[model samples]
Target: MVPPLVLDIDGTMTRPDDSVDPRFFDVLPQWDAPVVIATGKSFPYPVSLCHFMHIEQNVIAENGGVVLSGEQVTTNGDGEAARRVAEEYVAAGHDIGWGQTDLTNRWRETEIAVARDQPLGPLEELAAEHGLEVVDTGFAYHVKSPRIEKGLGLKSLAPLLDRTPEEFAAVGDSENDVSTFGVAGESYAVANADAKAQRAADVVLEESYSEGTLSVLEDLRERA
Candidate 1:
């Protein structure tokens, strides 16, 4: 059987331009098992992707701070605390960079996201002071509780899907994906993956971006 899949969105499923490849809209819905979108993005992003793709709403969002499986939702981390840290970061004179109407975090429930262009050192310092942690997803830096991570999200979601963490295949291309890679039975990092992700994955594909994700799915189909 083709195992269920957990995928990171930004650098993994997106094209070089950052838009999701249209091919996935055609493919993912037809997969034999569930496809869970795991990312550091806010809840609405992945949930919306599933909605538009005509797939089930299985997601691990906010870098594992929130999870959704059908009607079941589980939340971890402390969004309030993360928000405090971000406020302190701003007080320290750094811009969160998304501006006042920042939709990047508008619907987020368990963590705060900062634009990648901002300095990481200050964000890290502020987060540590608040007993929170900062994770770089290649797309943004997230402030969240240290205990929350995509691996934990997978563990929480697995039982709900009547599967084990080891029954899922994971694919990604950044530091934020490392935890999920460690928990998945099989993991793939796209050719453009950072060193951390490449080290964590079982295989590093030659193709980059969504092309690499397609390669992973194709290989899984053959194995099945």
Candidate 2:
């Protein structure tokens, strides 16, 4: 059986400007197996997208801080530590922003999602002080517990789908998704991915963004 596909959202399925490729919503539903959109996006965003596509699969959001399976949402990691770290960044004059609405905090659960414009070195240091980790998702940086990784989320969801980590593959374009790559037996990175991400991937596709995603899916179909 073909392994289920886990995907990163921002730079993997959308243009640099954040607009999704028209083909994604069209082709994803055509796949024969399940797809998990494992992204650094907060929980609701990907969940709504999946619903819009009429695809059913557990989603890993908040850089693996939260998992949504059907109507059930499970949160993992240290929320208190994450919030403390976010406060520190805000106090330091970093532009820390949350999800689009005020209620985003009600569900994000694990990591503090913030703008990626600031240098990660210092932010990482601050997160470490709080016993947290910083993950760069290309579009943003997440401060959360080490336990809140995409790999962990995938493992948590594996049993539900009756799939193993080796029976899974993931495509991503950022540092956060590296955790996903580690657990996924087969890992892919788009050409536009960061150097670190490319190094971690089993295959780095020549195409970028959604086109790269489509390429991997096509290869999977042929293999199946």
Candidate 3:
């Protein structure tokens, strides 16, 4: 069986300020099953949670874009198509940026981060000429890599975890979490999620991000 829940960080587990819900920490320890953090966030954020939560399992970072199973690291270059799309936007000069994530907390000075960055600028025109869509991740704008977003990321990790589509769940509250929601057994979005997220979620949280993390996980606890 796969881990019961795959939690998306950022807008799901924490607020836009990068704070994890204390309530989640308060209650997660009592659960007996494994917690796999599935996120578009870099490695450091999830790593900190894993250490503090005493969680030991595979982590899917980079929006399910990268898989870290213990010491192993596998990133799907599938974002290549998406990268090209993003570059088109950059080339067009509309102000889009991408490559990798650099979000972090000052307290966790040396957290592990995945996703690399490329130079930005003069690409927006490129995207416009090509008529491609650019995905905005709050911190940066992703032009296009592939259909290889979060859902594909999860699909990549499925075999390694030995889980089917119906056995695992994904939870989040933002645009980056959409692809994950597409493939999760059960999907949820936090109350703070934007319209796009609301459309994708199977359930929406009543609690804010702080409490939402716990509430979302509590749903997982029921399955656990």
Candidate 4:
């Protein structure tokens, strides 16, 4: 059988331009096993992706700070602390880069995302003061509790599906994905993946972006 899949969104399933590759809408809903959307993005983003893809809404969002499976939702991390850190970073005279009406974080429940263009030093410093950590997703900087990670999210999700983390395959492409790579039974990092992700993955695919994800799905189909 094809193993259950945990897929990262930004640099893994999206085109280089950052839009989701439309092909997934055709592929994922037909997969034999469950497909979970895992990403550093806020909850609604991945949940919506699954919704529109016509797949079951299984998601690991906010860099593992929040997880959703059917009607069950489990949240981890100290989002309030992360928000405090972001507030302090703003007080230190830096823009979180997203404006006052920042929708990027509007519905987020368990962490904060800051624009990548913003200064990382102050954010990291402030996060440390609040006992939070920052993870660079290649799309944004996530401020979350160090105790939470995508690996933990997978672990949380596994029992809900009557499987184990080691029964799942993962695909991703950034520093934020490294922890997930470490825990998955098998992990693939696309050619465009950051060095950390490539190193953590069991295989680094030659194809880049969503093309690589499609390749992974193809391989899994063949194996099944």
lDDT of each: 0.93, 0.82, 0.60, 0.90
After superposition, which runs of candidate 3 have C-alpha atoms over 4 Å from their true positions?
Answer: 1-3, 78-124, 127-133, 219-224
lDDT of 2 by residue, 94-187 (tens): 7566445735455676777767666677789889999888776667777888877888889888777887877788999988888889999899
Task: Find the number of clashing residue pairs for candidate 3.
Answer: 29
Task: Report model 3's TM-score to 2 decimal places.
Answer: 0.70
> Lowest summed lDDT over 10 consecutive residues: which window, candidate 4?
77-86
* Error at 18, model 1, angstroms: 0.1
Residue-pair clashes per prediction, in order, are 0, 0, 29, 0
What residue runs in model 4 are displaced by over 4 Å at the alpha carbon? none
Off by over 4 Å in 1: none
State residue 142's C-alpha deviation in candidate 4, in Å.
Answer: 0.9
- Model with the higher TM-score, candidate 3 or 4: 4
What is candidate 4's local distance difference test score? 0.90
| Candidate 4 C-alpha lDDT tens digits along 1-224 | 99999999988999989999999999999988888899988888999899899999999998898899989999885478878887888888898888879999998888888999999988998888888888888888988888899999999998898888888999999988888988889999999999999999999999999999999999999988
Native-to-model Cα distance after best TM-score fit, residue 205 in candidate 3, in Å? 2.0
Highest lDDT scorer: 1
TM-score computed on alpha carbons, candidate 1:
0.98
Q: What TM-score goes with each of the models? A: 0.98, 0.90, 0.70, 0.97
- State the local distance difference test value for candidate 2: 0.82
